[model samples]
Target: MARPVPAGTARADDITAKARIRNAALELFARDGVEGTSLRAVAAAAGVTVGLIVHHYGTKEALREAVELAIVERFADAIASVPLDSRPAGRIAAARDEAVADMLAASPAIVDYLRRALLDGGGEQGDLVSRLSQLSAQQVHDLRAAGVASTNHTVGEQVLTIMVRQFGRLFLQPLVDRISHEFPEDIDPSRTPPRLTVELALDASRADDRD
Candidate 1:
């Protein structure tokens, strides 16, 4: 149940219109690659004029960049749910898991976008991957600092492995689901650290925190 916008809300520079355009582009881009989608298609999906899209975003490439930015923000916001500073390890672990679970559940389009971006590959897309890896490194460093991450794995190793596993979910997970005959808890490691990496540390961190 969404709240209605007020009367006289100008279409130009309206947050709603921008968000609508962003979401529409995300969906269309995920379903049909950026090459296949058109400004008119995005405008139609967003229920706004093609002229309005051009006015707001200028071009399809600009619109794609906007969608990429929104996707990064979603991942960042999920990480932000548990600040990396001196929070309790138990709380951080729970919050991290909850945040990622919520993000994956909510952002199927984002997952699809990630799949396309990672597979397609480009300079800008490479930047997106680098940012995502940096986010993973942040979590690994903090979890280790909090004494919740394994000491055995180097931070670089952990970061690399985490990125591989999370992106693997984007491609292999469908086959995994088919073979396993069950859905995953739907945690996107791209959005959070892998469950096993942190779970193994939970008891140790809780013990260390009490000492």
Candidate 2:
């Protein structure tokens, strides 16, 4: 007796199912950690059959890898868009902020996924962080090459500092949300945070001008 593989009529042409499965998996994985989520759950959320998910992604682990890869690629694109070579060091921040804001606006689920992945430190999360670190290192190298960053300092140390500060914002978010709500309508505690401290200062400056 021949055993059957789970593969069915699914084809490379099943773009709709593939896209739906990826989105649904990303959403569910964000809400529930990858360990807590299952192919059945993903299929239910995606409104597809487990067999179809298998036909497209082969396994839960593979699907998770795909999701992580997608996130990393998108973030790389966002970071790469910054004019690191052309902009003055101080002016680089504004461009980076705009790129990040746009990225978050397009994919709101990213915040949750990042929080979960970073906290859990499981599966491809380490790889995701590694890829991000590589991107950050590249940014630092570019800044140094442009004579904007500390040329005499250790670039590795600088990269570590940048990584820590970025992760700190996400890891210490409880304090951030509690304190950053005076102008509730103008601020969003839920979205991936921007430089609220700087933004608040800008608001204060605007208020002073009006007064």
**Maximum-TM-score candidate:** 2
lDDT of 1 at 156: 72
Can you give the TM-score per candidate against the true fold?
Answer: 0.67, 0.68
Instruction: Per model, state how many residue pairs clash.
Output: 0, 0
Model 1 Cα lDDT, one tens digit per residue, 13-40 = 4458877877788888887889988888
- Local distance difference test, each candidate: 0.67, 0.66
Extract clashing residue pairs from model 1: none
Span of ten consecutive residues with least summed lDDT in model 2? 1-10
For candidate 1, the per-residue lDDT at 45 reads: 76
Over 4 Å off, model 1: 1-15, 84-98, 123-126, 140-155, 180-211
Task: Kindly report which residue pairs in candidate 2 clash with one another.
Answer: none
Cα deviation of 151, candidate 1, in Å: 6.7
Error of 2 at 185 (Å): 16
Off by over 4 Å in 2: 1-16, 122-126, 179-211
**What is the C-alpha lDDT profile of model 2 across 1-211, one tens digit per residue?**
1111123212234448787787777777887778888888888877789999999999998998888877777766777788776576776745665575577556656767888877777545367787777777787777777766664446565556565555565556556767666557777667765443222212343332100
